[model samples]
Target: MNCEFVIKEEGHLTQSENGPEVMYKEIKTEGDDDIKSETFPAGDPLAFEDTKLEMDQREEQEDGIYIPIQCSQTGENDFTCESLNDVSNKSFTRKPSDYTHSNEKPYKCSVCNKSFTQKGSLKMHLYLHSNERPFRCPFCIKSFIQKSHLNEHLRLHNNERPFKCSFCNKSYTTKSYFNIHFRLHSNEKPYKCFVCSKSFTQKSHLNEHLRLHNNERPFRCSVCSKSFTQKSHLNEHLRLHSNEKPFKCSACNKSFTTKSYLNIHFRLHSKDKPYKCSISSKSFTKKSHLNLHLRSHNNEKPFKCSVCN
Candidate 1:
C-alpha cells in the first residue's frame, strides 16, 4: 500500500510499506520542474530530522549570505564579507591589525626613497618623479598629472579671479595668492631671512633673498649668456633680444622695455621735479641729475684725471 501527502506548494511526501518495514519518500520541485527526491526509513525518525537540519544549513551556506557589521577600527557600518575582502586585498603583506596600528611604511619610492603607508599614495608620488602629464588643459598647452591641479591651472586661462581683498579692490586668481597679497596691506612680514635678518611678505621673496646671499643666479639669458638673480630681470633682458618695447609714453610716443623708464619719461611731459637737493633747495626731474649736483656741493671728483692721480 501507498499513501501520499501533499506538502505546501512543493512536491508531496509518499509513505510505503513492505513487509514489517516502513519507508517515506520526499520529493522537492520548483514551478513545473522536479528538483530532487530522497527516501527516508520510517523506523529512524531522529536520523531523518538530523539529515533535514543539515541540508537546511548547507543551503543557507551556499546562498553566499553576509551580515552588515560596524568596523572595529573605523567605527563605520560595512558589510562583513566585503570589508574583510578589502583588508585582505591591500598591497602590504602585514595583517589588518598591524596596518591599522603600525606607522611602518612598506611601500617606498624607488626614485626619492619616500615612504608611504598606502600603495596608492606611493603611486601618486611616482608621478612627480616622471615628467609625464596625462591631464592636458584644453585652453592651453600646459599639462598636469592630477585632474585637480589641471582644474586650478585652467583658472588662469579663464581669467577667473574670484578671490577679492576687503581692504583693497584688488582681486586674485586663488585664495592662497589673495591671502599673500593681503599681507602687503596688513604690513605682515611672516617670512624672515635667517642670514640678513630681513623680512618679506612672501616666502618666495625670502627664498629669492637667500639666493642673493649664496650668490646664485639661476636665471640665465640665452642670447647674451648673462645671468640674473631674478626671473623678471631675465624676462626684461629677453625684450632687448626681441626688440619688444611694451611700455610707451603717451605724450612723446617713446617706447621702453620697462614701466620705470616710461615713468621717468612722464616727468618730462608733466614737469614733475620730484628729486630735491636738501642743501640748495633746488629740485630736478631726475634723481640722477640731483645726485650729480650733490657731488658739486661735496667737491667730490668721481671722474679722476688718471695721469695726474
Candidate 2:
C-alpha cells in the first residue's frame, strides 16, 4: 500500500520506516485523532522476521478505534494498491503493531478465545475454528475461506495463468507465486537462516532449509515410516509404494510419478538436450547422464564393485 494521497480532513502528519519494513505515516486529525497509513515494499511476499516490529509500549494517547481500508483492491500484492484516506468511509486510529504494544485486542473469537486487533481479521481467523469455507468453486468441489483463494482455485480450472515472467518461459496463476518465481531470475535471496547464515529467495524455502539444520522431518510416510522435510517429497516417496504415476506426457502415453520427471520426459520427444559435455560437444537429456559421460573423459571409475575393490 503506497499512501501518498492527501486526506480531506487534514491535521498534522508524521511517518517513518524500520529497515525493509513498512513505510507508514501517522495523521493526527482534529481533536487529536490518529489516522495511520501504511505501505509495504511492492512484490515482496514475505511477512516474517523482517516485517516484525515491536511497537512503542506507551499509554493510549487517543480514545478512538481503527479500521483498515485501501483505496481499491487489497490482496497478497499490497504494493500495487495506492492507499487513500477515508476510502469506504473508514478511519484508522492505530497501526497494526499497536495490538502488540498496548495489549489491546478488542476482537475476541467466540470458539477459540483467540484475540485480534481488527474485526475483519478476527472474522477470517474464525474460519479455522468453525471449518467454514464460504468461498466455493463452481467448477470443482473445492472450497476456500477467502475469496482471493477461490479466485486462484478458479484459475486452475479455467487453465488461466495471467502472470507471465518477462525473463523466463514461466507463468503463475497468483501474483505471490509469480513474485517468488521472479526472485530466482533476479537472484534476490531475502529470507536468511539465523543458524547457518544461508539465504533463500522465498520464506517457505528458508523454512524447508532450516529443517535440514534442525534434523526435523515432520512429513512421515505411513507405509514405510520414512520421514521427509517437505510434504511434496513425502508425496513422491509414497508413489513408490502406490506406483501412482499422475503426471502424463501430452506427446506420448508415458507417465511419471513426479512433474520434474515428466518435464524431462518431454525433452525426449522435443530432442531438447540442455545438458552438454564441454569437451566432446555432446549433449544429453539429463544432467546425471552428462556427468556419467564426463567421467569417461577423465577415466574416473568412482563406482567400483565390492568384490574388486
Candidate 3:
C-alpha cells in the first residue's frame, strides 16, 4: 500500500517487489529530522532510471584519469580539467588585459618584495638573491644559476656550434647568440641610447656607449692608475705596465702585447702587403706607408715647417 524510500550513506536505494515495502530503516539522529521521507511506487521506472544515472556518474568520476585540457585563451597546454573546474568554481579566470588592470600577483618572493603571477617564475627569480649554484660546468670552474645556462656553457668547451644564421651561415654555440647575430643581417638595432639617440645591435654595446656619455671609466689600471671606459682597454694597458708580450709571432720569436702588432710583424716574414694606394696602385705592408704614398696624389702637406714660421 505505502512505500518509503530511504537514501543510504552509500547513496543507493534498496528495492522490494509487491505492496511497496520499506526496505531501508531511516536512522533518527539530531540532524536526521532534515531527511524528508518520500513515497514512490515499487516499479517506478523514472526513479530507477534517475538512480542508475547518478550511480553511473559517480563511478565514472571515481575511475576517471585526470585529463589535462589546454587553455584556449592563453595557448598554453599547462591548464588541466581539474584546474579548470577549480578555477570555474571560483570564477578566477580573467583576460590578459584584466591582469594588467587589476595588477594581480598571486605569487610573492619570500626574500624580496618582487611578485609574480606564476609560482615557477618566482622560484626561478629566487636564484638571483642566493649564491647557490649547483649546476657547474665540467670543463671549467664556472658555475651557473640554471641548468640551461650550464648546458649552454658546456657547448663552449665542446666547441659545439649547432645554431646557424640563415643569411651569412654564421654559427653560434647558443640560440640566444645566434638570434643576436641574425639581427646584424637584418640591421635591427633594438637598443637605442637615450641621450644621443644612437642605436646599437647589442645591449652591451649600448651600455659601453652610455659610459662614454657619462664619462664613467669604471675599469682602471692598478699599476698606472690610468682609467679606461672598457675592461679590454684596461687589460691592454696592464700589459704595457707589466711589459708582458703575450701575442707572439710564429715566424719570428718576437712577441707583442697586442694581436694587431703581431699581425703587422707577420707581414715582415711573409711579404703580404694588404694596404694599397688607390691612386698609385702600389701596395704596402703597413697602412702608414700606403697613406704616405697617397699624400703625393692629393699633394696634402700634413707636416708643416715650424722652422720657416
Candidate 4:
C-alpha cells in the first residue's frame, strides 16, 4: 500500500510495484499550491534522475494531464480529479535525464514564517525558536542549533583568528563583525551630520555630533536639571549633583568634575599664571577671575545693575 507523509529531509520513496516496474519522474512545483498527485516509478529509491520539471509556468494541459515539458522541483496534485484523468495527467514520458541539484523549497517555518528551500534549513530555524541548542562547543559552553554553528563558536574559545582585517592585524570570529569594524579604518565618511556639514564613520557618532551643533541636551542631570548632549556628559554632571567629586586636585584640596578639569585647576597652584588682566597689571590663577577683573578695569558693566539703573 502507498502511504503519503510530509516530505522532510529529501529522500527516496522506495516501493516494489505489483505490476510492471514503475519509473520515477521528478516534478516541478515551484508555484503550485496543491502538491501530491504527480508520481513516477523508478528502480531504486536513492537514484537521482533527470526530468524536465518546469516550475509553475504557462503550459498546455492535455485532457487535464499536465505534460512534463521541463524538469522542476515541484508539482500540483488534485485529489478531486477522476482516476482515468489522474492516470492520464500522471503518466511519465521517456527522455534523457540530466541529474542536477534543485533549489526548490518543500517546507516552511511556523514560528518566524520563514520559508526555506531545504528541510534542514527549516529544522535549524526551528531550533532557534525553541531555544534548543543540541550542538555545544567543547571549549566554551556556548550552544548552537547546528554543528556548523558550534564549530564557528569554538573559534573564539580556541583563539583561532580565521577572519583577518585588511587594514589592521586584528582578527574576528565572524566576517560580519569584521566587516562592520573595517569601516573604522577606511577614510570613508558615509554618515553625514544633518545639522552641520561634518561626517563620521558611524551613524551613532554622527548623531552625537549633531546634538552639539543644535544644542540638543536631552540627558539631564536629575539634581540640577542641567542637561548634556551625551549620556556620559550627563553622568559626569551627576557627580556635581551628588557632591561626589572623584577628580581631586593634587596641588590643592579642590575637587573637579573631570580629570581634564582637575589638570586645568592644578595650574592655579603654580606661579605660572599666564592669564593676566588685559587692562590692569593684576593677575589671577583662573581666566574667569582675570576676565571679571578686566571688566572692572574697563568700567564696563555688561551685567546691568537694574536696581541702580
Candidate 5:
C-alpha cells in the first residue's frame, strides 16, 4: 500500500495547490517501498512529529479520509478536508484542538435542517420547536430564551407607557390596546337606518330608536311570535304576554317586569320617600311619584299639551 502526505498553510486549508513547502527529511521504511513521506511547515516541532504519527496510523489502518473518529484519543491532528463529508458523518472530540465545524454538527434539526455549528445552537433551537422559554425574569417570572430578552422585559416594571398616540396624547404600554382606542375616533357608520335618514354608534341603539319610527318588531320569543326591537324589551314584553312576573316586591309580594319598578312598589308599602323633589319638600322614591305629588301644589302644568284647551 502506498500513502501520500499533503499539507497547506494555517489559513489556506481550503485552498488546493500542487503541494505545501516540503521537507527534505526522507525515511526509507522497512515494509513499504511505495510509501511517500510528506511534511507541512511547522512553527512548533512537536506538533509536526504528532502529525507524522497520525498520517502513519491512517496509512496502516487503510481507512478512508471520510471515516469519522473520536478525535480526543487521537490528540492534536491536522484535520483533512477529504475526511469530512457534509456534517452528519462525524463524531465530536473532547480535546481542545477538535474545534472543527465538520465534527461539531452531527445531528441536524428536521424542521429547518439548520446546522448549529455547535450542539448548543441545536439545543436552543429545540426550545423554538417546543415553545419553551426556560429562562425567566426574576422580578415578574416571565421566561425568555436569551438573557437580553429578559433584560428588555424588566423595563415594563416601571409603568413606563412609552408608545404614545399621535392624535390624543394618550399613552399605552401595548400597541394593541392603543389601536382599539383609535377606532373610537374614526366616524364609522356601522349602524344605518333602513327606513329613515338616521345613524347610530351601536346597532342595538339604532334598532331601539327605529322601533319608535317604524313600529316594527323583529325579535320574538320562541314560545310566542309577539315581537319587539330589543332582547331585554322582548323579555319584559313576554312577561306581559305570559303574565309571568319574576321580579317581586319583598314588602308586598306584588311582582313586576323590572326590579326598579318592584323597588318603587316596595316603597309604596312603607310610604318611605327616598327621592325628594328638587323644588318642594315632597319626597317619593319614583320620579313620577314625586312629580305627581308636586302637581297638587302647583295648578300650572308646563308639560301640558298645546292642542289641549
Candidate 6:
C-alpha cells in the first residue's frame, strides 16, 4: 500500500555517498487514520514515488507537508521541497499538488464556528479564541499569538524604524501600521461604512464609526450597565468603579485613571494653554474647559437655574 510519509526538519534532504537521505519518521497509511511510523536506515534499494506506484509502494506526503512541527522532529536533514521531481533549488512549496485544492473542510473550530480544509489550519485558528500567547515582548507586558508578531513588536523598543512611507516620509516600527498611514495619503479608503456610507482607511475605524448608527456597544462594564464602543474605553470606565488611578503626575503628585488624563494634567504645570476658544479667543489648559467656555458665548445653558424657574 502507498504510505504517506511526513516531511520533517524543514523538509530538508541531505545528499550522502550512499543516496539522497530523506529522514522520514511518521508514515501514515492510505486507508486509516492511525499513523504507523517505522524507521528503516538507508540500504540497498527502496524507491519512493507518489503517482503510478504499486500497492506496496511508499512516497512523500501530498498536502500535509510543511504544516509546521517542532524543530526537534526535523532530524539531521538539509532543508528542501517543490515535489520529488525538482529538489535542486533548495526552495520549498508547501502546496504544489492539485490534491490540496479540495473543497471538503473536515476540521472546524468550536469557538468561532470557523471551518478549515486542513486540521493544522483549524489548530492555528483556535489560538485567537484563547489567551495562549507563546511569544512575549521584552520591553512591555504585551504578548502575541505568534513569534512573527512579537518580532514586529520588538521594533518599538529599538531606535530603528524599518518600514517607511514614500508619500509622507513618515516612518513606522511595524509594516501594518505604516500601510494604514499610507492609505491616508492616497485617499484609498477600502473600509466603507454601510449605514452612513462613510469611508475609512482602516477597518477598525469603520467598525467604531458603525457604532454611532447601529449603537453596537459590545464592551460593557460589569459593575455599571453603561456600555462603550471600544474595549479600551470600557477598561477606562472599569477604573471608576474600582476607584483606581494608575497614572500619577510627577510635578504635583496628583493621580489620574488614564494616561490621557495625566497628559492633560501636565499642561497645568507647564502653563501650556493650547485649547483656544474661537468666539472669545480665550485660551484654556484643557479642551473640556475650552468647550465649557464656548457654551457661554452661544447662550447654551444645559444646567437649569431652579431658583429663577
Leading candidate by TM-score: 2
lDDT per residue for candidate 3 within 34-53, as digits (tens), equals 44344455423233322322
Candidate 1 on 114-137: residue-level lDDT in tens? Answer: 996555456557878898777889
- Candidate 5 at residue 201, lDDT? 60
User: How do the residues 188-261 of candidate 5 rate in per-residue lDDT, one tens digit apiece?
Assistant: 55678887868766666787988878887778877767777788877787777788889977766778987777
Best by lDDT: 2
Q: State the lDDT at 135 in candidate 3.
A: 78
After superposition of all CA atoms, the RMSD between model 1 and the true structure is 21.4
Measured with C-alpha atoms, the lDDT of residue 139 in candidate 6 is: 81
TM-score for every candidate vs. truth? 0.50, 0.57, 0.53, 0.32, 0.28, 0.50
- Candidate 1 vs candidate 2: the TM-score winner is 2
Summing lDDT over every window of 10 consecutive residues in candidate 2, give the lowest-scoring window. 51-60
Which is better, 1 or 2, measured by lDDT? 2
Instruction: State how far residue 134 of model 3 sits from its true place (Å).
Output: 1.8
**Which parts of model 2 have CA positions greater than 4 angstroms off?**
1-115, 274-284, 287-309
* Predictions in order: lDDT: 0.62, 0.64, 0.62, 0.55, 0.54, 0.61
What is candidate 5's CA lDDT for residue 85?
32
